[model samples]
Target: LWGVELDPTSTDPRIPVVLSKFLRANPGDFKAAETSLRSILVWRANFDIPTLLTSEDFPEELGENIGVIRPKDVKGRPVVYHQYSGVDHKAAFGDLDRFVRWRVQLMELSMLQCDFLHADSLLMIHDYAGVSIFSYDRYAKAASKKTISILQDNYPECLAVKLFIHIPWWGTSIYKLVSRWIPEATRKKISIVSTAETLSVLLTYIKEDDLPKIYQ
Candidate 1:
């Protein structure tokens, strides 16, 4: 575990307030709240977020069809778009470890952009139109699990909503299995739209011009 310290005077004032609220909401679960807050701090340090923002590794990821869009959502949250079809786990990344590292770097970059908008959360759109089971092979599956774990455990309240569009029937079963790994609160924010028409639901949170052509 990364070293975690609670320095009141040097820390963000809002953090303590959030921590207090978490403890209050959880009642006698002070230990759980403290642990959760500590993990957030540890992730901040261990993620090497500042280095990722300036690192050249980011351009490769962005060029590979992973990026944070310029427009903020209706609520001012940043939007992170992923083209699942564009990703070739073995051919593009070579191995699971490398793939996961690239994913973590990309996530850090997106989170950095979110910070500039004074947003703690982000809206994610994963386009699975052309993706197939081949894309979800063992390597990709392992990486996806790790990615979800990082997001759910370390990132803490950073996901505002997720729109999974163009999912096939086979993909639904995979999503059902994955849903079990996600927290209920986060699961509630996830929507799986089977057709392009149902994508209108996203317009409520994202503007038409802001959406990519495929979703529009």
Candidate 2:
């Protein structure tokens, strides 16, 4: 994997991190965990995820809008700020296949920020202010569902926590679209807040200095 050591006796702390991910994702089912690990390994190679980290094959502006933000959270974990409102969702997700690849590439970029030995997961921030029912159309929803499926199955346990902020009452449906993709265990790590309380709540996890200027 990705040049990181996986052997338990290799003296690399990342080895345990890798093993723990499988164990946590599969629980006590050693057989299922082995099966899943093999599947992810094959998926990673076929997906060419390693090259995605070095390639400039995707549009830079798209990354900004989807937000694989570089800023670390309060605990030094990588943070991703995905802005859902006031964005050109159609242009960003017009080609669902390409969009998913680009999204995965951005995710890889964020994951690289983690040392894995110390910070093995990411803090995800979702901003939904100014979003309307018509904004999150079919294309965006489809792209979201696809990306979530890929990450949950192939990546596994990379999301430490997620916060849905500045969400309007109508944005409940927006969350609902992808909520199914978040497993029950992962859902325990999420927080959803109204526009009025978003700032204070977000600041508790992400320092103001590290938070994006747009969110501030």
Candidate 3:
């Protein structure tokens, strides 16, 4: 129903405000709680998880994958990885060959999620490449069109579903580039969504109730 753009830096600022407000407003909606926690879980994998809150250090490598750094500290200074908090899916799939397969697999799953969503609770997704999730390889316009189409066909009640997509303005170019390369079916699905309306829907979900639980 809503997505809040939170600064992964200072969790104190918006997480508490938005999360607490949402929970209080929707007490019985356990799905919202779980959905919120799922997002936090991804953040924790990269950064510290403060009571289910995430502190994102983007454009950096994750600790698990970082290497080539010295073992000893230099004069008591903290050691840091060059790519400390970033998710390069390209690296995960091994090499070029595997990456392609992985992308295709992910695209298929995305299609499935779009087509066969059968839950009473709404589905909320955030991030710059929420749509780009369809075409991991490149932003093929056709792929984006297909993603949009699947979504439109499956998700008849977009405005009613508790979905929130918080895409950063900066990533728009990359998103477009990735989206443009997608097949037409996916592209058609993306065309229906207006960025501004998505933001509005997310903001509405950030009620005063959800804010309190996040701080604790």
- What C-alpha lDDT, on a 0 to 100 scale, does residue 183 get in candidate 3? 44
Best candidate according to TM-score? 2
lDDT of 3 at 204: 42
Which clashing pairs does model 2 show? none
- Model 2 over residues 1-216: C-alpha lDDT tens digits? 634756756888787787788889888999988898899888888988877777658765476766767678888898888887667877788878888888888787777788876788899888887778788788887887898788888877889998888888887776776797878888898888999998798788888987777768
Candidate 1 per-residue lDDT over residues 128-207, each given as its tens digit:
88888667876667767877887777666667789887888787899998887788878888988876545777788889
TM-scores, each model vs. reference: 0.79, 0.92, 0.28
Clashing residue pairs in all predictions, respectively, total 0, 0, 54
Between the candidate structures 2 and 3, which one is better when assessed by lDDT?
2
For model 2, what is the error of residue 82's alpha carbon versus the real structure, in angstroms, after optimal superposition?
A: 0.9
Per-residue lDDT of candidate 3, residues 65-177 (tens digit):
42222121212211211111244544443343333333333222222322112211223332342334433444234333444444333222321221223443544565566
**lDDT ranking, best first:** 2, 1, 3
Arrange candidates by TM-score, descending: 2, 1, 3
Q: Looking at candidate 3, what is the lDDT of residue 126? A: 28
Once superposed on the true structure, which residue ranges of model 3 sit more than 4 Å away at CA?
1-85, 104-126, 129-164, 183-185, 191-216
